[model samples]
Target: MHDLEASLLGGDRDLTLRDLADRAGPGVRPEDVQLFWRTLGLPYADTDERLFTDDDAQAVARIADLERSGRIDRRTAVTLTRALGHQSERLVLWQVEALVEDVAQRRHLDDISARLVVLDRLTELAPVLEAQLVHSFRRHLAAIAGRFAAEFAEARTTEQADPSALPLARAVGFADMVSFTRRTAGLGSTDLSAFVQRFETAARDIVANAGGRVVKTIGDAVLFIADDVVTGARVAVGLAGELGGELEVQARSEEGGLTEGHRGVTPVRVGFVQGRVLSRFGDVFGASVNVAARLTDIAEPSTVLTDPSTAELLAGDSRFVLEPQPPRELQGLGSIAPVLVRQA
Candidate 1:
């Protein structure tokens, strides 16, 4: 066995499934152990195969301790395990791919060669990357805790809010990139990667600077949320004006014309709303989210739009002008007047 693999596993893979269950202490069923493996996005293991290690046993034991102590429920434990598995899977893939791309770029290697080089260097890089991941996890956790505190420090009881409606009253928005498919129809891998990374980086930066949280970046759009409508308005306007306008000017510039890279792919249409939304599984949902998306579809390039209800809320704010547009029928959302929002 490789030394680095052994170091990571805490020993050779000498333990069988049965051995793992036995070492996990009392009340740790073998089936539950299998469930744990499955929840970690691994396949079910044979009972007699020596495919397990001390690290596996230790993880099951620790979770067993928590369960026995009543600190965590079995269902939630599984969910939490799945969360770690899912997120870590994506995170590592993204991190590794970025490393491969960087290495390929620097050394002028092809895809397979870059991958081989990356595989050889990963064990050495793993420790450093793991430390950074821990640091980032801690920082993000602290930020979430801080947000929770600020949100609930002076909150009203649940019953005081509309019982039938979604619990959280948030500002939801979407910024849809105009004609994304048309813009990059035949781009190669490097160009495509750069295009996506650039958009995501810019969108995330805009959301953060505008007091909004990016829910996620869809392939052709980004979803953002803010604590209040005004903040969401700022987010919406920034995506439309700052990001989209930047692209529009690029499309017309000497270096950014269609003959160059797809710098001509310009402008994003933004839409936002102030309403109750159900926040779950790292995304938001509700009428507001739906309306925001629908409005984005109808918005012109480099423009921001909102429902009348949301616009009315921002109407009193001096930072924006609410231009009322005629009612338009949105698929599954009925005919609704879209109001354009722009900075004063």
Candidate 2:
């Protein structure tokens, strides 16, 4: 088990904190290394502990060089480092848990035995998994770059980007599974896993087909975003058309859209709004996100609702039909007339 550490970390963990700091670079300090580790959600090592490796030293040196060369400031550096810390931890855990489940099932072992087996197998699997992680990360980076080039190519070079304004002109919303607790109340582990996995799988396909990106899926809900309103409208209506029913066209009319589903088919209510959103910590924030969530909560099962402004944007598009629902007072957002979106 101790030897596995060197294999996974790319070298022996032979350097103390002070030794690693001096070895990192001329500008690197012990505190800088501490900051990086701390931001990565790790506990501090004792001053004399040899828990770090050359790979760790290189990472610190790289960050310090970026700061020294004015390529990145401390705050930005912290943000980037923290992002890696946050996502990397989740990614590794997700993979490891999947492996644990697989091992338990395949070996006919209990969960505890499976976990022990996984610990023994991890050193063998680490390199392959690490390669895939790097490859997938690079592909995502390219995808983002393509979005920027295609979306911002016509913008004036002299125009200053508003740092305070919600950065992306996005369509953000949540699609929550209707009657989630009631539906899953009696399911066993395998059944629940299948249910949730089915929703996420289908939701991902729906979002991708509509040219939207799924931000993340909560246990019983999915958060999605699109570059513009039309695509967003497509995503919302698509979600409804595929796995939902129609809601009232007017304000709370008839309380419709809720319908029965066959086994394996889950109902969802979607709501999205077109507005600027603050993208941070790998998720979105701001009023638009809140409003969208509010609209979703108010929405009948299988319905897709949008705020009045988003409705107006989609109103001009021939692909969708927007019905003006009367104004409803939404919590935190005051009075907003929700619009029901339908495919033409």
Q: Which candidate number would show the highest lDDT if scored against the true structure?
A: 1
What tens-digit string does per-residue lDDT give for candidate 2 at 100-199? 8899878888889999999999988988998999999999999999999977874555475687886678999889989888877755564566567667
On TM-score, the leading prediction is 1
- List the lowest-lDDT window of 10 residues for candidate 2: 246-255
The Cα error of candidate 1 at residue 190, in Å, is 0.6
TM-score of 2: 0.89
Q: Distance from true position, residue 201, model 1, in Å? A: 0.6
Clashing pairs in 1: none
lDDT, model 1:
0.85
Candidate 1 vs. truth: CA RMSD? 3.7
